[model samples]
Target: MSQKGGKFTKEYEGKKTGRFTRNNEDRKNTRFTRSNEDRRSERFTKNNEDRKSERFTKNNEDRKSERFIKGHEGNEVNETRPVREDIVEGRNAVIETLKSDRTIEQIFVAKGNMEGSINKILGMAKDKGIVIKEVDRKKLDFLSETGAHQGVVAMITPFKYSSVEDILGLASEREEAPFIIILDELEDPHNLGSIIRTAELCGVHGVIIPKRRNVGVTSTVYKSSAGAVEHMKIAKVTNINIIIDKLKEQGVWVYGADIDGEEYCYNTNFGGPCALVIGSEGKGMSKLTKEKCDKLVKIPMVGKINSLNASVAGGIMMYEVLKSRIDKKMQ
Candidate 1:
């Protein structure tokens, strides 16, 4: 009986050991499977990160390329755009420019709108060997700065400025006393233009304006001058007071137009070599400039309004000077 019990115990012990070994093996296999899944998840995460990195790099490159293209296009547009001051519009202005010595780059006429004076412009342009182009009215409208193009626009060289010596030389060549107009910071382009037209008609030698605080020879001035700008010599000076002193030394009587003047404009003697100084529209003249004048003269006023438009007063004063010269010539 004792030997049979021993065999039973050894068999039971061996079976228990085998079952425990199998359970240990199952745990190992489960751990290995979980490790393998962890490795796969890590690889998937790395691949996703790489894809995200690639997308981010591509997006950056696309943005850079887009900016480059837009910048290139903007440069092209800027290069093709015309300068505003280089353009001259309107029929009379263009025709007068054509008749002048100014260099016309090209003349653009509105298509199917060439009729009365346009034919004359074509003839004049042909005579001068200028290039004429027919374009849509929209093109002219776009190029017109004065909004009164009248179907004709001329692209000309920038208005050339003359020196003070050149202006005096022109008077010498004409064998006339130096009849000059010196503006004191005139702001209005229309007023400047009208004054220039009147100056041309009155046989004035040249017009002088300061480099600062004055309207330049713009398209509006050109249109207002009725092409008279072409025939006029305009000088831009650094110091108008210095120029006034120099003119006084040269025996040129410097007259200032002011509301409060000792003498009327018609009574003033403008017969000699003279420079008529027209003040600004708002302020009559700078204190320093007024002090520099040889004489301050006023236009006669009987109307309720004591003040006159700068251009109107300037015109009246200019006519008075011209009348003085004519009267002197007759005497």
Candidate 2:
């Protein structure tokens, strides 16, 4: 097009006519996008390295921890497994244990059941400064696996087992001598509780059992002992036979309770320091256990059962031992 003052004219409008027209803004946008992409790429690389470092740290820590635990397996470190439900129920059977063991956490009493004879138990608790809580029936039901709690349950740490060597040291310190019960897998906690109670009553030193096969203290055992397990010195060993051998070394006469043995408990001399071995209910003493006993004697059965509950058998034997000691003292 021709204008009045122009010989030739090319009409160029705004700075936007295709790629070069928007070049400045587009370059700005491109630079912005490139900056953002660069930031994102840097962020991704940083995150990847962080994750890798975290995994490496965790793996090495796990391996080191495994090695530390593995190295300590043979060493004597205090270890515990969860106490069995029956054992929890029976904790009350050993009342003295409630006082002696620092690990007794708490006692649960049924809402209205903490009265009367149970009141004395509360009194003991009060004296010992134990914490008591009144829980709902539902809570108690959930806690006590053995339905026989009869309104009382104790939360106890695993029974603190002292060593046979520790008891031997106790025996060695005392001029009066040691009186111990060497149980050959007495399976019932009730019997154990009662015997422990009796041992405490009769002034026996401590009771021993094999680590495996024997009944650990249970809620029932604790209940049956009427709190006796708490007071009696008890040792749990890896091997019952090893304990027997140790007892014999320490001058403790080994006596096994059996029907076919030569002498009756009444006739046998309990004049010296002694270890009484009682067997399980169905299988009395294992053959190996029986073979280790210096003497195998039976408690005479007047009743037709021909066998006694381990606790009863043990109680009888404990009293006999006590009586023998008394008789010897009199002489």
Candidate 3:
């Protein structure tokens, strides 16, 4: 193109052209896109932080629940102490328990079912003065683990049997003349417990019971003994006669309680180290057990009831023996 002066001159423009303009535009576009990318990155970072915070909070809550549940095993959720349930049910089970020297916590019987074996149980319970509660059959059913509770259930303490040596050691530790009571094949835990309680009160040294064919200490016996089991030394032996022989060798005179005795209980000398043997509930004394006794004494009964309850008779005999010892000590 020609200039204003009609002279042949090169035309030049001051405005920027092609490549540089395009470069400037590209730079601006890159800046804008970078700004957008930065904003998106901030948003994504914020979102990730929020998710992490949520996960942390959830994890804390789960940990707390785990701790709470872990703290209570086989125990109440709110209870501070752990507790265990020991439930024994059934007629013969309960009966045999009562017969054995066991610590019974409580007895539950079905209401309105007090005949037959249940009656026998009640009689045994009464003789031992065990705590009995008559409840609905459903209660027994709920308490029954075996599902064969013949209208009765007993809550007993865990049994802890002692050796004969333990009893002798207790006597030796006391430094007093050993005054022991022996139960031969006595079945009722209540009777045994009652005897133990009375013996404790009377300051007896220890009590010996046969392990077989006899009630070893049970919860019912412990309860019936009125917690005297804690104070008294009880020894369980395989054979009652062997223990008797051992006692005799230790210079302890053994006396047997029988219906046919050579002398009355009052007349029998209960001085020095002596052991009194009480028989089972139904049978008085076994032939072998009777032979083990150094002497036989009887409790004079004037009542029409030919046989006395084992516990009652044993209690009477225990008092007599204790009284005889006291009288001799005084003299």
Q: lDDT of candidate 1 vs native?
A: 0.87
TM-score of 1: 0.74
Candidate closest to the true structure, highest lDDT = 1
Model 2, 1-331: lDDT tens per residue? 3573243222343323444657877998899999999999989989989999999999989987665444332222112223464335533452555556546677887798766656776887788777888877656655554456666677777667777777777767776678888888777666776787788898788888888988777665666767776666678789999878877997889999998888999998897989888888888999998999999999887877788888788889989998998998899
TM-score, ranked from best to worst = 1, 2, 3
Score candidate 3 by lDDT.
Answer: 0.75
Q: On a 0 to 100 scale, what is the lDDT of residue 176 in model 3?
A: 70
Minimum summed lDDT over a 10-residue window in model 1 is located at 70-79
Where does candidate 3 have its weakest 10-residue lDDT segment?
7-16
Query: What is the Cα-based lDDT of residue 180 in candidate 3?
Result: 86
Clashes of each: 0, 19, 18
Q: Estimate each model's TM-score.
A: 0.74, 0.67, 0.54
Report the lDDT tens digits of candidate 3 across residue range 1-331: 3455343222222233545677788998998899889999999999999999989889988886665455422223324322223555666557766787877778999999988889998899999989999998867655543345678888887656577677777778877778888888888766887888789888887788876788665544544665576567777777888778888889989888899989998887776788889889998899998988899989898988878888888788888878887887798
Ten consecutive residues with minimal summed lDDT in candidate 2?
A: 72-81
Which of the two candidates, 2 or 3, achieves a greater lDDT against the reference?
3
For each candidate, the alpha-carbon lDDT, in order, equals 0.87, 0.74, 0.75
Task: Predict model 2's lDDT versus the native.
Answer: 0.74
